[model samples]
Target chain A: MPSNDKLFAYNLGEIVPLSEARLHISDLSVQRGYGVFDFVKVQQGIPLFLDDYLDRFYQSAQLMHLEVPLSREELKQVIADLTERNQLPEAGMKIILTGGYSEDGFTPMNPNLLISQLPLTLPSDEKVAKGIPIMTHDYVREVPEVKTINYSMGIRLLQEQKAVGAEEVLYAKNGIVSEFPRCNFFLVTHDNTVVTPAKNILKGITRKNVLLLAGRRYKTEVRDIRLEEVLQAKECFLTSTTKRVLPIVRVDDVLISDGLPGEVSLQLLQDLKDLEEAQMTSPKV
Target chain B: MPSNDKLFAYNLGEIVPLSEARLHISDLSVQRGYGVFDFVKVQQGIPLFLDDYLDRFYQSAQLMHLEVPLSREELKQVIADLTERNQLPEAGMKIILTGGYSEDGFTPMNPNLLISQLPLTLPSDEKVAKGIPIMTHDYVREVPEVKTINYSMGIRLLQEQKAVGAEEVLYAKNGIVSEFPRCNFFLVTHDNTVVTPAKNILKGITRKNVLLLAGRRYKTEVRDIRLEEVLQAKECFLTSTTKRVLPIVRVDDVLISDGLPGEVSLQLLQDLKDLEEAQMTSPKV
Candidate 1:
């Protein structure tokens, strides 16, 4: 059954019933997945990682040659207006830009946009504190760096990992670890080095912050990592806007750090928490 | 310069200015390219290949595990309502279904729908009658059968083809010829046989009809054809809802039919027209 609860959604240029926000059948973005967008968590009525997310989003759009008519400042205002209208404190915000409708009927011309606030249920306190288990799969994001709407395989990978009783999936191609479907994958080596896949992953905002914090305390390297290296890691973790710093206690039945969150993982989690708390107390921009 | 004249567009269930329809930034479809949709042509105020197009569209949604809240009948009615509202005589219709806002703050629970129509100009008479040149690229659709929004590479391929003065780009994978970015590829072999890629291509409605008619008069095979085989063909053609059956006079720089529209290509085009006329004039189902 579909959810009938009302939602405040912005379609085109007006606020409308969530049920009525529809896209045309011929939209190139919808028809061929020819669009790019960004997602930011709204914490205490403020959007986190807004600029970073938009920067990456626009980069992907530029790569695809999708004309984003709105200036960066204008888009920020649109997002701020959307969040204010929705009155969502701790929710998710989405901005979509399609290749728009074309007059020639073949190529896309105008871009389509929609913004909305989503209901969010955070992970239980116990799960968040104790961390979560994860599984590694030999799946790769087709365009690992860019956030685009072509994630059928990624979705399937997530489902498969969930079915196996894991919280997330860390994907690798040809035994070279790539990244998680919705998060960035990182590992700590025996030599006290923190490593992640160089650019074959989304340049996640949360992940970036984590990397910055880690660099201050430990030797950090951004390089290609093999499955063998991941399997031998002393600790593993995933990072995302929502996930923050989540430790992977086990991968594909193999225990990492004696099947418990490693010290390094816990340290990173605490660091991320401190960062979030600081942001929460900081003055509004 | 961008076109200043805008066409009327249906946004979220309401008719709106073509420049206004927009999607959210946090939508999983836009953020991760996790959505499905369909497109078809409207001719003489009627959507051509409506049923076939919708069927394939929903099939794509099914593959992605997206639920179309509207039933087939309900959706048809909605599309009809949309077209009537737009009052488009010959246009392009688009339908986009995105995984809606989710409670998890990461994944969505519902799907968003958007429908719109754009005033479209039909193919130029000279190009339709005389056919066009095409370029061959060794690229493969990541997921060959289902048409998803992962079209960055496809669009890039098209731009690359056009740069060399070609109208379309014929794709090949490991020496095997695939379809065009938005059309199905066909070839008339030296043995006078008509062939297309067996599967791995969009089951285009127009392509199916053309194959059926062509098979009635000639030995037609839907089997894998190598790039070498296609390059050695006597005549080549491409098919889509918009182009119908268009001859490929050249591939790269090699002449297909003395660098002109061949007899076989001309015959297939005529056959396609006859089939369309027959279907349109038939009594109501």
Candidate 2:
């Protein structure tokens, strides 16, 4: 699908064309792959869980030593203005913080921030219902706790995942499943416990919300979920801003829950949607 | 000081302006930090050790699964064309290979290759005479063998290094000195043995030449050199395409041999200069 032609996007405090929102070639984001970013879902022109996202965004920036060019209130105001100017009821707001260009190519001088909103491409009902298949690979991310723009291993494994008829690849190191390429991996144990890796993975906002929802309804264990447990899991799912509690029906051609989406995964997804619905019905921020 | 104004740079097989050399936002190099690059020094319009640099560039590309869009011969011709067009007698050539933009913004589709030539800024005489001071940081890059663009940790420590009046940071993990942020580090032991890390480095082209020079004249050991050994070494230095064999008279607060450039490191620098002189005086490619 083609991207929506927006009249303006938040580019270094000024609204510019989405097509023309470009950074210098010397920025660390382009030169050294040093950057941090966060995504939030905007519904009915209201950004859902803005505080959670901005908090995590700040954490990510601090981890990478990228100073956000704007203060918290200023950043929020920029996002609100972008949401208003774009006039999109539903979209994905991506906030990127990069170490700005330096005189010497390798040094960090200043920080640059850019905000862009992309029209949401809702997942197809058929694919959502059938769930997505993912392949597993033995890999792990550096500084796995931060939402940095270093996805080299994940992108390299794209072809191998496609060849296996999978949509994503789950990363496992030493038989311990850590994360999916770009999302948080969760598994429902045979005893009806929700387990996800607590280390060497990004603490995704969606994963946090799902954990909160799961805690009230079922037993939740946040620890290292090994590949062996994943293989024997009654159900599997991934969580991200774009994919909230997406079901995983198969792994490495092994049918998960008889190749069906489990009830718990669907229920948690409904929980997130309910939260989003409440925010959408409320007044805009 | 400033980049040379080249009429065209090789951009995905098409020649484009140096200022217009831009990649799509969805390219993995920008979005995912999945890319590899190598730099070759050109003096007097001569590309020094072009073959060795390209071989390492291809190795780095293969390690990251980034396919170069052009063959070695084609790439050489493009670099030659870029050099001639730029008309820079002394410069640096940066070859970049990236997984191209994806339709879904998460997978590799096509590959993009670009060659850029930048005007060389000669280092100050004071910096050369006094040598450079560096601080040791306990961090290691992912896939340290490949020259990928993931320098998140190094960039994060730029401020600390600057605060200490250091030119760079030497990466050490568990007291084992592996490499500098962008160069291979070497130390001259008390017994006059040349030592460098055998693993977790890019195997610099300059390092290769210096190693050859040291092997013929001194006792050389290509193995893990600890930080303690570095503090106690008679002298220390770094090797890279741009910096060549630069002496390190001080690391953090500890001064090497009373903060004087040792004879071994100076000799190695002279050896690299001699090799470059030979290359430049030879027939231009």
As a TM-score, model 2 comes out at 0.90
Clashes of 1: 43
TM-score of chain B of 1: 0.90
Error of 1 at A33 (Å): 3.5
Identify the runs in model 1 with alpha carbons over 4 angstroms from their true place: A1-32, A41-51, A67-96, A104-106, A110-125, A135-138, A156-162, A275-285, B1-34, B39-55, B70-125, B136-138, B156-162, B253-257, B283-285
Chain A vs native chain A, TM-score per candidate: 0.91, 0.95
What docking grade applies to model 1? acceptable
Candidate 2, A68-98: lDDT as tens digits = 9899999999988888888886788888887
Q: lDDT of each prediction vs. the true structure?
A: 0.74, 0.82
Worst 10 residues of 2 chain B by lDDT: B1-10
Question: What is each candidate's DockQ, to 2 decimals?
Answer: 0.24, 0.46
Q: Estimate TM-scores for all models.
A: 0.79, 0.90
Candidate 2 chain A: 10-residue stretch with minimal lDDT: A1-10
True-vs-predicted CA distance for residue A197, candidate 1, Å: 1.6
Candidate 2, B1-285: lDDT as tens digits: 124345456776777777676665555666667788898998877899998998999999887777888889888888888888888878888887776765555666677776777778665656777898889988777688888888887887888787888888999988888898788999998889998899877788888999999998899999988898899889999998888888899898999887978889888888878888888777343
